[model samples]
Target: MLEQEKPLRLAAFDMDGTLLMPDHRLGEKTLSSLRQLAERRVTLVFATGRHYLEMKQILANIDIPGYLITGNGTRVHDLNGTLLHASNLPEESFKTLITHKWPTAASFHVFRDDGWVTNQDMPELLHAHQFSGFRYQLSELENISASGNSKVCFCAAHDELLALLPVLQTCFGDRLDFCFSAYDCLDVMPVGSNKGSALALLTDRLAISLSECMAFGDAMNDREMLESVGRGLVMGNALPQLKQQVAHLEVIGHCKDQAVSHFLQHWLNSPTLTYSPEY
Candidate 1:
């Protein structure tokens, strides 16, 4: 007798450029498809670099499922708002980042579930605030230093952010983790904390093997989770650098076209559909 294949037990998605459309809205078709997957008992998880509170508000209209691996995996919580796992960058590290005289023009923010704290006021920071829909407090880092924040972020011009990476890596690479959460934003978290680590811990608890899971993503921060899963599907709109960085990743439809939903529908309903790793 042939052995039964391990069923696809979980579907993980990165929000911004993987699941949500360019407008940052969940398309109705995608929502319906997600509901169908939920009904079939396929656990759906959203892993993002978003703050828990901001993600909560953004997903308020939809019944997004399973667990949220937020803050680039510094925090994880269940649908019921139960904290499953959490790791925060040390306060000293946060201070070190905030206090260091950045060689380039950059805006920084420290994030918690309730709100974010920032010491600088810049157009880029304001743009990020609008893009993320998270409120910020204009105060010294010391004022909010006591809060056990999940992460620290730096927003700068594209070129400036790229140039600042080497400096940051040389200075804080040993103590802190850095990920380009967006093209112009860098997120700093604790060492050994990332979306992939979060998924591994959650999967272990769920009694599912990594080979039984699939993940979708579109950015550098999503690399860990996307690469760790048995099947990693990136959006057509994913950054070119991200595409080149990971091996055996397949490019699916664009998020603007609701590729995730279409992919899920086809994946769940069609048995003959197969993934070709030769991208």
Candidate 2:
């Protein structure tokens, strides 16, 4: 049981398979849990690899208002559309990506403040959108030279992205951070841009301590975020390596809408558990 003096004040969720179910939709029970948590004054935040505009459409149906960490933490915004922070990649990094020895079958995406820009045509963009339903305003790569970008993404098979990571890291180094947000996609954003950093920024702004926060996730990108919070939960469907990172061995059930909702209801009703850092 958690000490009464230190209660959870915030809950951070990873969007894709963590919060949303296998069908790519939020379940009724999950929504109810969110409402219950809100009434208890626990801040709810959604952290995802998607951009704000893309996340808004899908989350519009929900009634709760909370902070959003989008573009894999490149930008942080509140529910009222207020921008709290953003980290944009340098122009040289973008230039380096465009000129890199990319896999012929791989496609790329660039996210800007106003909209998404991609050199590939709409068909290619559409294919990538299968993984993340982010709305984009496609542009030719030639016209993208002057645009400020927050992130660059490459969509291809896993092997393809793996083949490109070392080369990209070698060229850009500290200028960018790299990860696979989806099974077949590789994302590049400014250094220090990630869900954990965004969470830190939001927590600081809200005056919430790290020990009073809980987070949920299911992928490589979610690793740091899970490790950063007071109580980090990995979904039953998470990768083995990811599951090993959590301090608690408690296994939440499979990631159906019911599973997430059930766990939240139980946790909120249970006594807060004192956090013991594994690191």
Candidate 3:
């Protein structure tokens, strides 16, 4: 196992595949574990590719308080919903994204400062965001400015997205970053923006170091944050490539089994839990 571990003062989690079940809802066990962590004085932070508003809806009835890193790191907010940092894409890059001719079946979603927008009707997307009650407004993406825009996403079949990935990289390689938040979702963001960078910013603001942080994730979008944390917990259901790369870290049980909750319970109950992560 990877040996580096300091006292964990902060814990970051990715939503969909890492912390949430396949149905995109947080279970009671996980919620209780997170609440216990906060009670122990550990600062809780959610580092997700999800939008802040959606996250708010997901955690609505619960009393769990935490910071949020949204838009795959384009926006960072504190517990009070205060904006700590924001990253915007360049206008030309935004223009390129809006004007690009995407695959006919691909549904495009954009997160802007004003509101969320989509190029077509994607009621299917609502299934995942049901807990959050956050929905996107349909638009032709015309007459929209880039001032507050941060992320653009395309959703299609897993294989279709795989085929389109290379084309996107070839065209906007240096200008933006593309990552798979899910098998079917390809998300694009400004260069240098990601969960890890945003996590670093949050930690810095909180007077903490990455060496004292623990984070859980399950996809390519979670890569940088996993690599940057003191202890990175890779889910058993993680992307094969990601699991292979972070094999040195703990490979927990499948998320559908509430693996994150199990780990947290162990950590909380372990008398040996200290500056080392033996879980």
lDDT of 3 by residue, 1-279 (tens): 223455779999998887899998889899989999999999999989888887765656677898999999999998888899999888888888888786546777889866689868868778987877788987788667867888988888889889888888888878888888888889988999999999999999999988888899999899999999888999889998788877787788878988898888877797366423233
User: How much lDDT does each candidate structure score?
Assistant: 0.80, 0.78, 0.85
Name the candidate, 2 or 3, with the larger TM-score value: 3
Which pairs of residues clash in candidate 2, taking residues 3 or more apart in a chain or in different chains?
2-272, 2-273, 2-274
Tens digit per residue, CA lDDT, model 1, 1-279: 001397788888898888778777778888898888889898888899878887776666475566789988988887787899988778777777767798987788887766777887655444434645676778887677644788988887778888988998999768988888778788888898899999998999888888888899999999999888888888888877888998568888888888888787777687465643222
TM-score of each: 0.90, 0.87, 0.93
Ranked by lDDT, the better of candidates 1 and 3 is 3
Off by over 4 Å in 1: 1-4, 121-133, 274-279
The collision pairs in model 1 are none
* Ten residues in sequence with the least summed lDDT for candidate 1: 270-279
**Tens digit per residue, CA lDDT, model 2, 40-102:** 988989999877887776567566777899988988998787999988888877787776666
At residue 133, give the lDDT of candidate 3: 79
The superposed Cα distance between candidate 2 and the true structure at residue 185, in angstroms, equals 1.5
